[model samples]
Target: MTMQVRGSKLAARLTASMAALALLGTGAVALAQNWSTTVVASDNGHKVGNPKAKTKLVEFMSYTCSHCADFAREGDAAIKLAYLPKGDVSYEIRHLLRDPFDLTAALLTQCGDPKKFMGNHNAIILSQEDWFEKGRKTTRAQQARWQFGSNGARRQAIASDLGFYELMENRGYTRAQLDKCLIDEAKANALAEASQADVEKYGLTGTPSFVMNGALLDGVHNWAALRPVLDKQR
Candidate 1:
C-alpha cells in the first residue's frame, strides 16, 4: 500500500485502540513512595529500573500512535514512581515504527544522550497532538521529499519542513545538532530493521503492545489490564 493509505489505516486502528483502552477505566493507583532514577538506551529500548530486575517488561510503541501516547500520559509516572523504586521489575520501551513521522520522532529521541532518551520520549509523546497536526498539514512538496534523496536527506526534510525540527528545538536541541542526527543512517536503519523484525516475530497488530519476560502478552494492552500481570510477576 502507499504511504498515505498505510498511514490512514494505522491512524484508524490507533484511534479505535485508544477508545477501547479508555473504556477500561483509570489506571492503577500511584505507589505511596517514589524514587528518583534514570533510564538508559539498550539494544532495542530505553531501559529503566534495575537491569537485574526479575520481571522484565517491554512496551512496543509508535510515536504517532494515540494509544501509545495515552499510555505515556496515564501510566508513565506510575511505572517510574511506583514500580522502579522496588528494584524487582525493569521497564523498557521498544519503538514500533508506524510511519515516516514515527521514524522522524524516533530518530530525534535517540539523538539525545542515552540518559535523556526517556525525558525526550515523554516530551514528544505528551505533545503528540501538536506535532502530529503539523505533520498532517505537510504540503505535497514536503511529502515528496521523502521519496527521493539519501536517508539523511529524507529525514532532514521531514524534520525541517514538517515542524519536527522546531519541536525538538523547543526541547533545547540546536538545529545543527538535530541535522546531524537526521543524517545518522545507521541509527535510522537499525531502528527500522528492529521494528520490522518485531512485526514478524510477534505478529503485532497495533501499537502499545506488551511483553513480559520474553513472552508477548495476550489480552492485555492497556495499563489497567497490564498492572495485574506485572503484580503477578513481582
Candidate 2:
C-alpha cells in the first residue's frame, strides 16, 4: 500500500512538470516572434490616440471591412479618451490587406513618415463610410478583380480610376510619390508577405481583431463592452 501511494505521487509530479513545460514552450514561441509595426508609402494604416503608452494595444484591420470602420467610428474615441491620454496604454495599427488594391492602400498609408502613423490612420478611418459605400456598388467579381488580379498595371489603373489614387493625392501626396508607391512591385509584395505571416502566426481569420497583451479581443462592435478587459490588464 505504501508503494502504491508513492507511485501515485510520482505520477502527479510528472504530470505537473509536463504541464509547466508546455506553458513555457508556448511563451518561448511567442517571444521568438517579432511584432514590429509596418508603415508604407500609402495611407492605409490608422491610429486614433497615443502611440507610446505602457499597455500596448495592437489592432489588426483592413480598409474594406465594414466592421473595421464601425470600430473606427464608435470604439476608437472611447479607447483614446479612457486609456490613451492617461499614458496607460499605447496602440499600434497593422494592415490586414485582403487584395492587391488593399495592398495599394496599405503601401500608401505606410509611405509617409513613421511619426505620421496616427495621421494616416485617422485619414483612412475618417473616409471609411464614403469609400465603403462607393465600393459596394461594384459587383463582387469586379471587386475580386480589383483585389487579386495578376495584371499589376491594369489593377492600378482601376484603383486610380476609382479615386483611391486621387484620395491620397488630395491628402498631399504628389503624383510622383503616388506613382512611385504604386509601381514598386518589390515593396508591395514584401508588405503582403509580412501581413500574411502575421495572420498565420496569430491564427486569425478576420480583420478588426485586437491583441491586448496576450489576451485577444475578437471584435469591436462597441467600446463599453471592451473597457473592462483593458482595465483588467491595467
What's the lDDT for all of these models?
Answer: 0.82, 0.67
User: What is the per-residue lDDT of model 2 for residues 132-162, given as tens digits with 9 covering 90 to 100?
Assistant: 6666677766666665545466447655645
Give the deviation of candidate 2 from the true structure as CA RMSD. Answer: 15.1
Please tell me which predicted candidate would have the highest TM-score against the true structure.
1
Best by lDDT: 1
Give the 10-residue window scoring lowest on summed lDDT in candidate 2.
35-44
- Which residue runs does candidate 1 get wrong by more than 4 Å? 1-36
